[model samples]
Target: MRRLGVWIRAKITLSVLFSLMVFFIFLVTVVITGVLFFLAHFFGLINDEIAKGGIVLPIIILISCILIGTTISGFASRRMVKSIREFIEATKQLAAGDFSTRLYLKSPPEYRILSENFNRMAEELGGIEILRTDFVNNFSHEFKTPIVSIKGFAEILKHDDLSREERDEYLDIVIEESARLASLASNVLELSKIETQTILTDKQMVNVGEQIRQCVLLLAAKIEKKHLDLELNLYDYSLSGSKELLNQVWLNLLDNAIKFTPEHGTITIEMKRPAGLLEMVFRNTGSGIDPEAVPRIFDKFYQADTSHSAAGNGLGLTIVQQIVSLHGGTIVCESEPDQSEPDQATAFIITLPSETSK
Candidate 1:
């Protein structure tokens, strides 16, 4: 389909040139032949003309017309080919990671449109390249930090003179850093796996509200540790999709809510079906997300808390977003600073189509 669309748009110029060249040659042949016949009859020398060359004039005129028409067509064809060649070469450069290449084509609406689209694609590729480079740098730093901490703490533990309390603390720190490293590795692998999936598999009719409740219960310990108040208004709801994937969505969101909410903070989970949309919202009270960070919160390796003080590798929300996308859903986050709103605060809302839509 895409190839056909391209051909339909690009073959107009060549088709017009070919048709015009054929018409020009035919017209010249007819007019030249008729004029020669008339001149021979007017001079009453038809027999003399026949003896002299027998249609030689019309044959010469026909040949000249064809040559002229061909030459003109060739020039037009060369310009068209040159422009196409430029597009091909630019595409090759782009494929080679040269996102800076841009087209500056002129004339012919089709070629102009092609150039504009290609340039826009190049610009997007350039932006993605930048994001990829930044992700790699951030990933390396994140991966190195935990490993270094573990190594440093282990080295300290090697001293026999250290008291029991000091040794336990050092060992705890090593254990915590090791866990962080493992979590980071797991999130990376999970994100890679989910992103490569084009369609959701292992789908089943899952009680989504029950799933959210289970996620909240699973994190009950952490919620209790923080002395946070939890509210669940989960009306019974079910969705037809990959159960394991949806489980990750709820788990990640609830875990994030637990991680970021302050002690004695409030966390609320709500599920409802409104206008054929299965909407779930997780709201938590905290310092609130930076307005600037809200837009990029789902981006991989982009953390609102850039200080790394939070125990996240920034892939949780990314994974959540991807899973929701695979399920043909949308997730959005809105935040307000402390005291900017009533008791309710920063919220992440996810909406999925009803099972019938699926």
Candidate 2:
């Protein structure tokens, strides 16, 4: 059907051009034939009947050709112009966010290709639009949750009937909710900067082992509270990157391990030079990520568990991945259900290129 439309459109355009050419030829033929006939009559080169026939024949031929040409031209021009107008209109509709609009044009192969390209573009636009809408909706809901909790808690604290302990408890709840909101906002802004390539990294040579140690220290309280065993196998390995961003990577990973790992579970950190690359691995006994969620683990605002009980805005892994990419490094995760232990075992392996390894 589409092919037929394209052919019809092409035919129409050709017909219009042919019609114009015929009109031009008709006019020229009539003028030249008239001049020749007049010259012959005036010079008496031919008899009156012959001259008259000559004049009449040329006029008759010119008139017949003009009529035929005009008819053909009109038919071709109409189809061609109509097809072009339809195509333009369809394009406008698409530009106006109507992805369903399609150009049913009968044109040549070139025009058919154009239509196909347009359709493909529209399909991509539609998909992006859907993603944008979903992102916006999800963002709004995420933002609203903390704000509502903070507001409710603040209002409760305002009541005079509440005792000192009750007021303090309410204020604590408000403070916690406020912190959650702040964290969410920060993550959103950071992700935007990363996506836009606006965030600059201050790269420098630093000890990767020390960075892991710092991260473990930061989460030392939580690890102790959980009674988790901490193990470190550090070698003299270093990496060149923004220390602050790299710290965030370690902090988020270690934090996640502490959060998910059960009591008495073990968390291990290892740094070594392997195959001319600096490799850092953080492993923990925790609930292994579901196979379905593994692919989306690094996606911004994506939580494997939708309940939001986890202590994160779901942007931690995303930030880690982005930082690693900025440093021209790679990170991977391996996990298995630890049936022998009380929890699953998961390991995150990070490899920095030898050129950047110090």
Candidate 3:
């Protein structure tokens, strides 16, 4: 049905152009014939020829011009109609999930531009399709693995032949798996909310430095357990933003730092006003991130640790980025991965407006 509509529109366009050309030819012929007759009557010229031949030459010239003009117009309209048809077909193919659809027009600069943009759109759509497929498969695997573990552990616990120690171990595994499942569900929900949110709620004046300190204090136990050194160089800085969302950013960044840092490793956090923007950096000493992985680090369900050995469900950074962006902020990761030096580390830098009225 849509294809039919497109065909009808193209036909109408061609018809209109052709009709305009024919009308123009007719108008020109009438004006020229009228002028010739006027001049002949005033100067008494061609009157005798007209009386004998009844204006046969003018009539023949008009017919010839109309025919020639109509043929040229038809030829011109054919190329345009062909380009339009190609676009319509490409649109249909794209709608049917063929992201490889591309256009290559040869004539006309305008058509070339359209073709270039169309191909670019198709390429982008193809990339987005791949990402979407990866997201679904990753989400399913991440979601199902914990449930399987929980089920297996639950089954083992139901055995009356098991010893007390074995039962306790199995119970612990089941509990941990259940917690993992809960965390996965919660992260998925938070990501969905942030993805759709375009505005901030519960907006207030949030102390940026204080939030980092609070996050540090909250994770003090982990820091001590890992024997990691915590260094804070926070100066008083505040921003108008969503307090709840920004807190998530700090918690995730600090937690990730603690998770990846080595024993006695240095985790340095510095806050300063740089280029009129409030800048904060969280650096941790470890085998930093891979260069290739840095670009996709914040993508939803993307995890550098593909082994699933980490403590997160891969939604933390994605959520942090969304929250920061909602507050008109930016987050970037800089890491010197696999360095020969012992002090090599990964760092995340975040910047935001100091005081947004919104």
Output the number of the TM-score-best candidate.
1
How do these models rank on TM-score, best leading?
1, 3, 2
Clashes of 2: 7
Query: What TM-score do all the candidates reach, one by one?
Result: 0.84, 0.68, 0.80
lDDT, candidate 3, 20-131, per-residue tens: 7567666765666567666776898655666568578667556756666666657656767888999999999999999999999744555667889999999999999998
Residue 358, model 3: Cα distance from true site in angstroms: 17
Clashes of each: 0, 7, 0
Q: Which consecutive 10 residues in model 3 have the weakest lDDT in total?
A: 6-15
- lDDT, candidate 1, 1-358, per-residue tens: 9989766556556457568656765676566656866776688856555547858755765675666556655765686689889999999999999999999885466677889999999999999999889989989988999899988988888898999999999988998999999999999999999989998768888888888888877988999999999988986678789989999999999999998888899998888788778999899998898888899999888889978788889899999999999989999998887566634668999999876422
Better candidate number, 1 or 2, judged by lDDT:
1
Candidate 1: worst-modelled 10 consecutive residues by lDDT: 8-17
**In candidate 2, which residue pairs clash?**
5-105, 5-106, 5-107, 6-106, 6-107, 7-107, 9-106
Model 3 global lDDT (CA atoms, 0 to 1): 0.84
- Compare the candidates by lDDT and give the number of the best one: 1
lDDT of 2 by residue, 141-249 (tens): 8889889888888878778899989988888888888888899889888777766774456677877778888777878899999999988898657766777877888
